[model samples]
Target: MGLTELLFVKMTGGNPILQGLLGGIVITLMNTFGALVVLVWHKPSERFLDASLGFAAGVMLTASFTSLILPGIERGGFIPTFIGIILGALALDLADHLIPHSHAVLGYEGLAQTRLRAVWLFIIAITIHNMPEGLAVGVGFGSGDLPNALKLMLAIGIQNIPEGLAVSVSALSAGLGAHFYACFVGVRAGLVEIPLALLGAWAVHIAQPILPYAMGFAAGAMLYVISDEIVPETHRKGHERWATFGTILGVMVMLYLDVALG
Candidate 1:
């Protein structure tokens, strides 16, 4: 398909790249705001962190299906989406093998230990966790469906708040300064999203045939993060009950947003 046809959204002024950039910015800002939540909730308990992470997992769980997988099926058929999902999961799994990183609770994983400090390893984990989110937003915008894009954007941004809070809180638990470092993390997170957003938009520009696969890929990556990291980490603490409820609430919120936005 032609570039013009690929980006033909009459409602949003028909600029997928710009829309994709904005989508990335909105989610990044949401994450930044999430990080800043540390100021108010200062010294939030580990129990709270578990619940928040669970909440993030819930949002992602639903978002993976509603915003990515289902639409991908509708637009491009099930086979491509299924293949995309498998490929996406494998890609992240491969990253896990190739890149060593440490989680706040799960501790160190990936390639054998290097000189990376605990803080840096921790940052690596978060970065790897966040890349899919950026990719999802970019693909949503790239889909040329403004309503779905905005809905996905809102859900992802909301979920990000908890993630950002979890990150900043973890930083503080490690005795890192909250403002400078947290904000720095937020900026770094944005850097991860913006260019990737452009890339997603641009990728679709080159070939519409890949759109379904792209959407499925994003969904699968998110599903992997939720299952492998967020859920397990949240349950490791003593707050499993609260964390479960948090996930329920998060799922409800995303569901509400999906209905409301549409």
Candidate 2:
């Protein structure tokens, strides 16, 4: 069989990878749908946006530890998981230095800051934030643990709603695009995950041993983003108190879901 046919079969034949991709896509779209409020109604307040960002970050942090890292250690072992986490964090750190992106409140970041347009900068920021989410979902499925994968997917999906709002608002505030168009931009940020999910699934399915490492890597990547990017963005404004409360709520919600569903 051709490689294309084999992939088609794998994806269509009840592959967890397919499930992860579909879940990611649906949630990502939901995120953009959240952004529609700006077009259909009004823009969210900065305080509200800060709180939402904190909430998403909290959700991601919980998922990384509970859903990704723990399972990774169980499947592979401490050494592999640890190595994967270090590598993952390093990879994102390098990207942060090399890629030019803007924070919602911090203006611009990264070393290669040329005269790029605000739209591209916004896109870069979104890419930095959303790429790890896709990886986590893919790695969750790749670990050969369907229940945890579903839990991770649902957790990420729920948080993506607020993330979408944050991204759309950031893009609009940066003057990247208009109403519905801005929402489209926010949605486009997550489109990179389809291929990423496929890659994660194929990798782990082919080499099952790497599943744990991959999971750890995904977790690390997400942690880096949450700590370095999302948290900073949330706290950069004066709404740190509200953001902290939002983060606590997010953690509680995810913990409840994990316990209830798991």
lDDT of each: 0.83, 0.80
| Candidate 1 positional error at 238, Å | 1.1
Compared with the true structure, model 1 gives a TM-score of 0.91
lDDT for each residue of candidate 2 in 27-46, tens digit (9 for 90 to 100): 66666676665676557899
What is candidate 2's CA lDDT for residue 25?
69
Off by over 4 Å in 2: 1-12, 113-115
lDDT of 1 at 133: 92
TM-score against truth, every candidate: 0.91, 0.91
Instruction: Please provide, for model 1 over 31-120, each residue's C-alpha lDDT reduced to its tens digit, 9 standing for 90 to 100.
Output: 888888777777788988888888888899999999999999999999999999999999899887789888878888899987877777
